[model samples]
Target: MTNDHDVVISGASLAGCTAAILLARRGVRVALLERRSDPDAYKVLCTHSITANAHPVLDELGLIPALEKAGALHNDARWYTRWGWIEPRSAPEGPELPYGYNVRRSTLDPLIRARAAETPGVDLLLGHRVTGLVREAGRAVGVHASTPQGDREIRARLVVGADGKDSAVAKFAEVPTTLHENTRFGYLAHFRNLPLQGGIGQTWFLEPDMAYAFPNDDGVTVLAVLPDKKRLPAFKEDLEGSFLEFVRALPEAPPIDSAERISKIIGTVDYPLVTREPTAPGLALIGDAALTGDPLWGVGCGWALQSAHWLAEAAATAAAGRGDLDRSLAVYARTHRRRLRGHQSVAVDFAKARPFNPGERLVFSAAARDESMARHMYMFAARLIGPLRFLNPAALAKAAAVNIRHRSAGVSPAR
Candidate 1:
């Protein structure tokens, strides 16, 4: 049977918009729906830092230039652990290392959404909320949505849910979901004149507690703290005070006292991990709809963009009627799992609010003392490489050698 569009994507955020733009560019007709009517609406609770793994995808979408013009900071990262700082040293002879962006969602979301709307074959439908899926012979074929004017049935060969953590489409499609518990909550606010060393983002792994200083666009720096739930009472009692105290206690912390607070502290008290199967017969889920991990690692935004690229690449041919849709979707699903499942598992394990394990201690301690180890750790943390490679036998052997050398020199591990 004929369909209204090739694909009807619910949610016009990062994943949806990226998918819409890429698919449309490949001659596929797309309906990009967003529940919010305002064009400038953005997600406030995000860490707003995109990882290096997603840089190529964003560049492919022609957003890198726009992002740079908007003053998005290209951020390198430094981590402070009990074993001291793990700083990756770039080799002057080697190719330049990849960098991620530190731009607020307030600027990022609208910029991308506008790009998608202006693309040739994408229909940006604002104020359209997906309420249910249209199923034919036990396969999803379309969606029923509540639009500004009235309820409407949008038919398509494939339906994509980029609607985020609490996905309406995933619910309607009855996808299997697994929930993981997070024992920490977080708060973040913006500041002015808060300069990090070389404008690099800093993450302090204060054992069970974590704090970050990410320099963003236009000289704005975001300060965030993810303290254990046991410290919630103090933070709830006085957010500003507790936030300041927690950040100040970090080793060689930024000069927050001299900086000006620019935004009100915003936070989520509880963010449970959500993982779902990304595809069915004629349905697919991208971004947070597929996997919502602990946000402390700042992987959400990057994964969203990357997943959109993967989905669009996989489905474009099928949507154009040149290939089987289900087969294409299966390819996308496998690719997504292979790329993100290990990272998600690590993030969930950390979200349990436990102290670092022995392997973690060895890696972090060695990284602090050895440049090679630090570079590998950086690659793993940046999501540029998978966990298996990072924890390979050779890496573990190198870590052990580094630790032995430091011990021979009588240098304290905590130093």
Candidate 2:
């Protein structure tokens, strides 16, 4: 059937913008709908750290230098545990893994939105919110959107929900959802002159708790601390003070505590990390809307861009007139699940308890003590190494050996 556009993407967030840009680049007509009137608007609650895995897509869209010029920071990582610090190591060429850039959502999000608008065949409708999906015979065909002008219909060949964790389009598409008890709250802020030690992004895997501070461009930094639900009462009482105090409580938090505040401490309590089947007839979900995950791994932004690319590729194939759209959606769904499910599954599972695992503790501890081990741990943390690689028998055996050697050397084991 003839439609106003090839795709109507809800939510002008990173995923939506990326999807729109990708599709438009491929010659598909795209309509991007945003609920906010301000084109510069962004989700302040997010860390806004984009990883190395997302670089290729950004490069393809010609956004890498743009983002870097937008005050994004290029920083390596270091992990902190009760035992010690694990620093990042250099990699030999070959599209170095775990490479990443960090930019504030305020800057990054708007830049992407603008790029999407610039792409040929892409029309951005700001201040318009999609209330529901339009379906015919149980297949999504378009979206019902409400603009300042009032409610109206926008027809499209496919509808994409990039609306995030509480996605209205996903709900309208009638996709089944599963929610888990995520009792953890995230508190964060932007800071200036944070006394960063060793020039590496750091995360303190505190015993039964965790706190992180990432260095960014423009002399700014992002600090976040995640405490169990039961321990949130204090933070909720005084968001800034508790957040700062949590960071200071870490074994190596003096540097962060010394930093000057560049923004107010923002807090999100019991933010539900959810997952659902991301696709169905004529519709697909991207980013948090498709698979809400724990922010602890800092995988959200990367996954969002990556998933958008996946959908764009699959959609191009499905729209070829030779393949069934259903089959295309299924393929996209399977690929997403296979690529991310294993990793996110482990992340969600680990959220249930403190960081432990004889092998893990051993390797992480060794990383803190040895530079080589630190690189391996950093590679894993940065998502350079796949989950299966870490689970390999050889890797496990190596971890065990490292653990024994460290113990014999009188180094405190990471737990």
Give me the candidate number with maximum TM-score: 1
Considering only N, C-alpha and C atoms within 3 Å, which residue pairs clash in candidate 2?
52-99
Q: Which predicted model would earn the best lDDT?
A: 1
Q: All models: lDDT?
A: 0.92, 0.80
The digit string of per-residue lDDT tens for model 1 on 145-164 reads 99889999999998999999
- For each candidate in turn, the TM-score is 0.98, 0.94
Tens-digit lDDT string for candidate 2 (1-415): 8877888899989999999999888778899999999989998887668777777888888888887787787757777776666766664553444577888888888899889888888899999998877889989999888899999899887889999999998888779898866657788888888867776577877655777778776777888888877787787677767776677777767566566787877777777778889998888999999997788778889889999999988886455344578887888899889888887777776676455666667666666666666766766666667778766787667767777887788865444
Off by over 4 Å in 2: 91-97, 256-258, 320-322, 410-415
Error of 1 at 170 (Å): 0.8
Off by over 4 Å in 1: 413-415
